[model samples]
Target chain A: MNFPPPITRLIQHFRGLPGVGPRTATRFVFALLNKSEDELRAFGHTLVDFKHSIRTCKECFNISLQDPCEICSNQKRERTLLCIVARPQDIQAIEETREYNGLYHVLGGVLNPIDGVTPEQLRIKELLTRLEGEQKFQEIILALNLDIEGEATALYLAKLLKSRVPKVTRLARGLPQGADLEYADEVTLINALKGRRDI
Target chain B: MNFPPPITRLIQHFRGLPGVGPRTATRFVFALLNKSEDELRAFGHTLVDFKHSIRTCKECFNISLQDPCEICSNQKRERTLLCIVARPQDIQAIEETREYNGLYHVLGGVLNPIDGVTPEQLRIKELLTRLEGEQKFQEIILALNLDIEGEATALYLAKLLKSRVPKVTRLARGLPQGADLEYADEVTLINALKGRRDI
Candidate 1:
């Protein structure tokens, strides 16, 4: 189909985003075209600033606006209690509970060798370094997904943290299997938090 | 949930897109953040150019890189055969069939009174002007969707075009009701084309 060059290019660009196929990409382009001139320019400016404005925390390896992130920098946080999760968004899910007042380690993703995601590819080194640093974390919690990849990652990290940290624990079997921590309700996460047991 | 400020802002921006909700927007933002820096920058550049690089055709009101749009400007197109569609993407769906060699007029959207969309709000005036112009369109095809709004708009246009053009027809009622032309299969459109009846 001979869409005008610029419109076709715009659709292709939209398709590059995750989960957006050809039809969705075309829909996005049309939606953008229908927007007001000011709104379009603002959206473009936001896109330009999106990558530039975000920073990875030096300690937690989470996406944020600052080097250490607000969660890592907050004085009230229980620095001795560290919770490790797969992705940055998982931290939001955990934080919403207000049940655990601990620091975090964002792995960015889990260990999935089939998908070419290895331990080294994740922020595992950073997690280890943070544990080794001045912050004497007494408890390290593995708050990962209940899937095969998440299980493998948990086992690998648990083995590593057990020798160094005073106590190493997993989020317990309360969360339904195959569920993402990012999408889990606060009650479910809270239950998992309360029932957490040492690995 | 308290996501990092910049990350949250990016999620909100993505949620503004059609068909995207809170969860999908968050997922899109995370996926984008996972992309390589160069790819992210290139995507930003494309977004900036998206609105700036495109123009509306003076004659058809369709989005294009040029003033009159490629379809309206092409001399080889059947100047007598004009296809009226709801949006620019509809034109792509129709063009995919390679069945219609006519020009198009994009109404931007169909009239929905409850949505405050009146005739004056759409490109109806431009469509009427085209009918009154020197270019004698022998057949004006109302290729709108099969929805209530689409049906209403097509009927309105058909009534108006019947008096001006030698022939005014609509795509056959072969399409399923409430289906968007943008998502209709090429085969469906082709069948509708073959069975078109006079309005």
Candidate 2:
């Protein structure tokens, strides 16, 4: 049987979300129906206010309430260091470590020429401006994906920034800390062997 | 790093959904934030209007647009036959088969004494009233779970409705449609052996 217009609409909305399919959407809608009127209204309010309440950092392009973002506004962070990443979520991944006190620049995405995502489409210009400006950045960390597109982008950026900046480094490649040697992929094993360091 | 207030609230709302936790909720919130302004607004509107649009069926207790529900209102459905289910979704499971043309009676849930779900708390009064009232039901199918609670509920209902109703039947226990003999549980294998019929 056909569901009512509102429920069908809600299901469609849920289906539009990443990783949610037809059955999952239906389940989510049913679960929502189980909530009290106040709870439903509260959730609805959150959805409605989400965009207006969250702002992209003008400096880092990280999603936050402030344009400069929490990281960019912090005074104690290293001034002469910058970490470039593909998305805002990657910043969270790095932030959770609490190791890197450097600022960030979200590229929006890696260079995917086939998908029409070029250097102009990314925050490459912004990255250059940040480097050229009064911040006097001494080091840049290109923490990006290992895919063909990511490598190509890294190469392109490295070539451009080599003359502009003193040092440009990529994250290390090796087997994960707890991973077994037998289960390691060929590329990872090769990289791990090639990049061996003194214990 | 802490998320914006709106984003954190949205994540909490997502976490309230079944099987969803902190990481999944955060992922869902990020995904929602990625949606366009119009799409997000439409989704919010759907959520806001959801409860107001869907009404519970007075006859069957199935959540629907109309009080009588689509099935209860349908002229083609068998008026004399009633399939009793533990929940409204169970009716959907049966309906997906496209076999049964009978009406349904959603019990909300089976009796679980430990959870304080007694006969008075359930739709048992409504079920009896339906059976005793103007609509003459020929059969009452106890399509409940096979758990101890469900079994106890079925037993209680069976004893009460045996003399009043013409027939009270339970779903047969056997191997599921696509199950292999080697992997089938002992109870199912035994039930399959016991309930074997002539070819």
The most accurate candidate by TM-score is 2
Report how far off residue B13 is in candidate 2 (Å): 1.3
Which pairs of residues collide in candidate 2? A57-A67
TM-scores of chain B, in order: 0.86, 0.94
- The estimated TM-scores of all candidates read 0.82, 0.89
Query: A161 in model 2: Cα distance from truth in Å?
Result: 3.4
**lDDT for position B176 in model 2:** 92
Number of clashing pairs per prediction, in order: 0, 1
Clashing pairs in 1: none
Tens digit of per-residue lDDT, candidate 1, span B1-199: 3766667776877787899999999888878776887776667666666677788889887777889888888898998999999988788889888999989999989999999999998998898888888988999899998889999999998887788899999876567879889999987788778878789
**How is the predicted docking of candidate 1 categorized under the CAPRI scheme?**
acceptable
Residue B102, model 2: Cα distance from true site in angstroms = 1.0
Cα lDDT for residue A176, candidate 1: 84
Segments of candidate 2 deviating more than 4 angstroms? A146-156, A177-197, B113-116, B145-156
